[model samples]
Target: MLENLKKEFLQPLEEFTPIPFWFWNDYLTEEELDRQMLAFKEKGVDGFVIHPRLGLPEEIGYLTDTYFHYVRYAVKRASQLHMKVVLYDEAMYPSGSCHGQVVRENPAFASRGLRMSARESAEEGELLIAAVKREGKTWYFWEGPSGGTIRGVHYGEDDGEAGAPASADLMNPEAVALFLQLTHERYYQELKEYFGNTIIGIFTDEPNILGRCSKEGMIAWSGNFLEDFYRQGGNEQDLYLLFADTDSSEGRRAGERYKRAVYERMSRAYYRQIADWCAAHGVAMTGHPEKSTDIGYLQHFTIPCQDIVWRYVAPEEEKAITGEHSTMGKCSSDSARHRGKRRNGNECFGCCGAPEDPYRFTMEDMKWYLDWLFVRGVNMIFPHAFYYSLRDRRKEERPPEVGMHSSFWEDYHIASDYIKRMCGLLTDSVNQAKAAVLCRSEKLSWEIAKPLFENQIEFNYLEEELLPSCRIENGCVLIRQQRYPVVITDGKDTPETRDFLRRLEESGGTVLVWNAALTAQKIREAVKPAETFLPPARDLRCTCLRKEGTEFLFLVNEGENSVTTNLRLEDGHICQIWDAWNGTIKQLELPVQEMKLSLGQRESLILVTDRGE
Candidate 1:
């Protein structure tokens, strides 16, 4: 079994290839498209996302017949090459506007938001959000919609802001339906034959409620948001609390209710609608939401996804381990695991270099980002881009293009093969985690996560929404074949979540409230990990997985410095070191109770052992 697994891991399937976003950013000719496709295929990358980006001349308008002609040619060529294609469902990012066609056709569908003012001035056709008197001052909240600004995709002179295009109201189901009619339906019409075969899925980039460039202090709203909120048991008085930052219990609860309502409405209006369309058409809906911790919306995705862009995480940065974005890798992966999905994806390495030195992106930095995602259980990778043309200003749209125009394009196969092997290994394996950290749909406990990573504790983030459906079995929380003997919490739980935790505790499960008093030693006592480190390497991260009858321990040095430690395992197990980078395996001597392990900065290693009977 080990030998067979080794053989399989060495030569991964094409499905595991890094499907980079092929930015169609210039006057694309069939000859140039075929040449770039051939180059990618030669470099071991068997798939690409046809991302329509900036720099295309007005002659080739978005979603025009000419655009479809080129897209059809690329899809046909991909089929001939036996390569997969994922259609990006937008001209440029923040999808759902159909490149402003949705709002252009119906100006009423433009993005809307709620604004509060002390003076009441009723404008014609303006929708009133709320009316509340706080501290004897009457506050009038009304819709303040804004969009349809024709700022093309380029870096703004002021603070390098990438101006957003006209965005439709994603909170409105009618607007979303129009978007699908213009974008997704057109793709299905053009490439109906390749729905589930050559063309695997459609990518919907982040679609927010109000979208980018919305007015400050305005909450995302739609024409019928108040009606839906009322239908969902929301009070009109609570609407005022959303505009204020008061810490009163009533205000806090009201804020949570409003945000929850917004998330639910957007999920039903936008994500669910798109997901159903894809499912009916035999394609998968794959994309991330606006926020990283928006796991509530991710449940609707066939291929749950999140993105790491603009240096949200880096090699030696604390952001990599202790930020809201850091949880995104696990956010998608855990959502997939709970939903019984095979793969989760991340769109990574976009604008990851320093702003002062955008071209300073290195192969080592790429490797670190890859390991960060793979170790967290993400199996599919969408490399930020492979630009078709880097002519003129197109090169600066999103800096540090890691594809055909990169400094390492000659040896691109090296990175491609590494991606394939790591993705292949993580795809079908069962994550062997004995603990779960409870989190809300929009909130993750980074305070708890930081300590857990430092202590080498392997766990998954379990959303509170999923707790009721989970079965409590013999002092363990079981759901979708994942069992957790211990559940950790950051102590900021909602009433419903607290009730669920109480039930779990009553069922013989260990509930650890994350606080300053709760140390790593206490966590070790509760989880009692299968493997232990001699001196507890703080910056070393590990994920344990099982495939066939073998166990694999993937370890990464997330810190800038080197780490040396002795790993101790059970006496009956046999260990081997599998090098994913070079596809090599080294057997260990018998009686391997304890072995010394050393890893350099941003380096990773895999320890394979037998599942002893």
Candidate 2:
């Protein structure tokens, strides 16, 4: 068993690496199904996500007897081929509505939101109005007035202008319960025999509260929000203030607190409930949250994930402008590392090429994306999709099939092997970070995070929820195996964080109060910089992880030109390079304290050692 485990660890495509064949049930046929799974196995793919998506014919019928029959065939074939099966919870994505089937049965269960629109009233009369909140701004409306009330309710609808199927209210427990019964429970009932064995877990897509929320002015609402807010120590009158544009400090504070309460209630109603359900059913819940940069909410996922969309640009450009979309991988990875999760996932390679230049995603672009993910500690790969049929319209649905039909299909295993090799090293390894920055808010945290990323200062974003588990020990904030000698507090300090800083200071740890321009002088003052790794020039990213007394240092070149770098270590040290290009681990003997290395454009390298080796 030990030898077998070791052998599996060395070559983990089947069990450890999860580039699951996304079996889009478009034109379901037993022969075609078997062929796809076997084809995936040939490409070193070892798992499949049974996704029933658009273009699936009406005759097959989603979640029907025919659907189950196809599902059984796929799962059974995977079992025979020694591959894993992960169930996609919904027929179409942005889950929770069960493809609008859930809300269609009961319109009351459909998602709801508060909308604020203004129109001129012909009658000149004084009217009492209630204020409503929309995207952090307040809008006012007359109470029960006719013709043109500024504040009116809007039912949940698709992002498109045309009326479509309504999204289920995730904040409503009843609506979520119905969703589970109609979708999740149905999967378990049909696939119970393989739940924990061949069937590994279920992937729940982002079940956002308001699907494709309006950009103009909209706020989410639930049937039980008012009472729940009051019960949770929120003022009933202050709720309206949350929707109002107030300049007073007290009013602004009240609005922030009330909005936070609403968010907490939604999380409890949706994520906590889904997590509990998955735990009970002997499966892991793996999926991204609606807003991936909301780090605190990531704790609810069993295998925290984020979706990487659009094009694969340089990391530096992504950091400068992309905001939440780009930094999602780091957010999920930090959340997972803090909670000791072994695997973090990403739904990547979607729309890599622009719509006009479809099927133009080169293998090099995929490599760059993979490097970005791995550097941030994302180990699991959900390669966006794999088509069950490239026939007719199914060919056009989420086109540029990166799987069996792509131009590089014959050489898919080359990329597959590299991903698995890197992921195998990342999994079960302890993160080696010496500092953490308080993730006060997304904007401020990213502001401070920019300098940290550019300088290659490895750290994690410490959320307030992780504070209780952290403590100052020997002049450092200690949590499990991770330690931070310096903790940077950015923006307005919260009372909780202020208290934490005081405790940390009293315990002889250092804290850097963030200024507008977070200069290197401030960072240098907080903690003396080390010389473990340095490049001739900047724009290189590196991260460290330790497992079983061996430390792994991963480095990537983020620039266009080849560069030479020196890895500083103890004199006469021995280091082994995990060369992805050659697929070999070659030993390195260092004569001096710094070892020089030359990396090509868009290239990366990993070094393994145990102090002197």
Candidate 3:
């Protein structure tokens, strides 16, 4: 399994091959495009994502005139050199998605961005459950106006008169039908034949739909959501009906539940819509977040439903926050007063406040992002972008208008090398989701206190004292309603743990306490006589070092004393030592038959064990 995993990890990665650089808005000159690819090819990049400049004289149609020529030429050229190619699908940003910007730029574009206006009257909300006929097909529209403040996003020179207070009026069935239809025509329909497998799937870049702000909310969706919600025993006959008033405690709970359910339905609609379309077309789809807060959703429902790994702003944010003397942007606090707070640097930095240092793609950033995303269930990435050339540009190529206006071209090689190395470890790690804590449907801490589940982040590891009785899975200490015998490594066993362990053992569960805390009486007290969460009546003991199912258990010396001790999980259970992280197993060379897995102050060792090895 390990070997197969390694092979799987390297195979897809060996083929991933991102196209090096691009010259986005540098519209004219096919000659220039060729020149860039040729230069990138010389630098050893095996693939790329190229697109035409928007609104160029030639970009009037789907792509610039020689678009296909460029694509076929690049593909043919790359193919000759054994490389892969990807076309930055037509258009860019909020409107480029579905030719939404094709119509005159909405005066509302700069005004509301994607906010909604006004709470829907109950009459309007309830109508969301009604089936409306559009083009002879009855479909569901949005149930109500969404609530949000559209005062933020900028669109060139602000002619902001606040526009009309608007919302994502999916409640208007006509709009819902058109959205679904447009999805089919724009991305699906014949995308399979158009790009075939060469284009692994549709990259649904930024799919923000709110046109204005609403105190109620303004998300867009099709008819399937409301009906499905009702079918699942929800009474949202009209979306406009305020299921819960968030103004008061009780109302807030109800509103939260309503919003959560609706968001789930809406999010799933998107996942399924793209997923189903992708499966049908023989490809997989990928998407990024509208904001950084959506990473949890991506872990549980969003990315899992899609085949590819997702990207988040954490990497950049973490970098900016910890980089040298730099501090996080003032707006990072999520405070109410942080509005209108730009970093005042004309470097044209985006969300993370400053651009990534192009010539120096930091390894520290790569390691943090890789480990973080891995634990979050993302096994793949397209990264921010790969430009065609680091060429100078001033005009818009198309919708996104995303130019390679950075040091990316110079840092190209290092970034690609880092990406390739990381992919090699990640691709095969997809199947490593074998063991996980089943978040209880009741208390629901897992829903909100999600960081605990993804506690592998370097600074976020468990504090053996606070959450000692935690179950080891995917580098996290799993906590639940009852006490567990599983050597919870993070904190001292809580008060309820003793009884839980006793019951678990009574039920044939084996409770193994971590050797790291054997010195503490509370640690032993936490593991009751009877086991609860593990096998019953099974022998359990502490091992200075042991192995259990693909994980290594090393009881580190929390105190600064070097002590040699006998090691064993159970009598005569002769443990084996292997280092899978580097593929150097069976290196346990010790005369006492007890090899020391050393740890200094705040040090740790992973004693991995796999069954049937």
Give the Cα lDDT of each candidate.
0.85, 0.69, 0.34
Which stretches of candidate 2 lie above 4 Å from their native place? 1-10, 21-25, 117-163, 213-216, 230-255, 312-322, 354-356, 440-444, 528-536, 570-574, 589-592
Q: Root-mean-square deviation of each candidate, in angstroms?
A: 2.1, 5.3, 13.0
- lDDT per residue for candidate 3 within 99-142, as digits (tens), equals 33221223222111111224323443333344434335443433
Candidate 2 matches the true fold with a TM-score of 0.88
Cα TM-score per model: 0.96, 0.88, 0.52
- Residue range with the least summed lDDT across 10 consecutive positions in model 2: 145-154
- lDDT tens digits by residue: candidate 1, 1-613: 7677898678877889999999888898999999999999999999999988778776788888999999999999999999999999887868888877888898888888888888789554467667888778889988857532333333331122544467888888999999999999999999999999999999988886776665677778888778776765668677777777558888887777788788888988999999999999998899899888988889899999999998888765688788898899999999999988889999999999865698778888899899989989999999998988889988887878999889989988989988998998898788989999998889887778888888888899999899878998888999997999999988888798888778888989899988789998899898998888878898889998887777898999888899999888743464788888887888877737678889998789998876565
Ranking of models by lDDT = 1, 2, 3
Better of 1 and 2 by lDDT: 1
Which has the better lDDT: candidate 2, or candidate 3?
A: 2
Model 3: lDDT equals 0.34
Q: lDDT tens digits, residues 433-519, model 2? A: 767877732322666666666666777777766788887787788876678888887647778878888888888888887787768
Number of residue pairs clashing in candidate 3, backbone atoms closer than 3 angstroms, sequence gap of 3 or more or interchain: 60
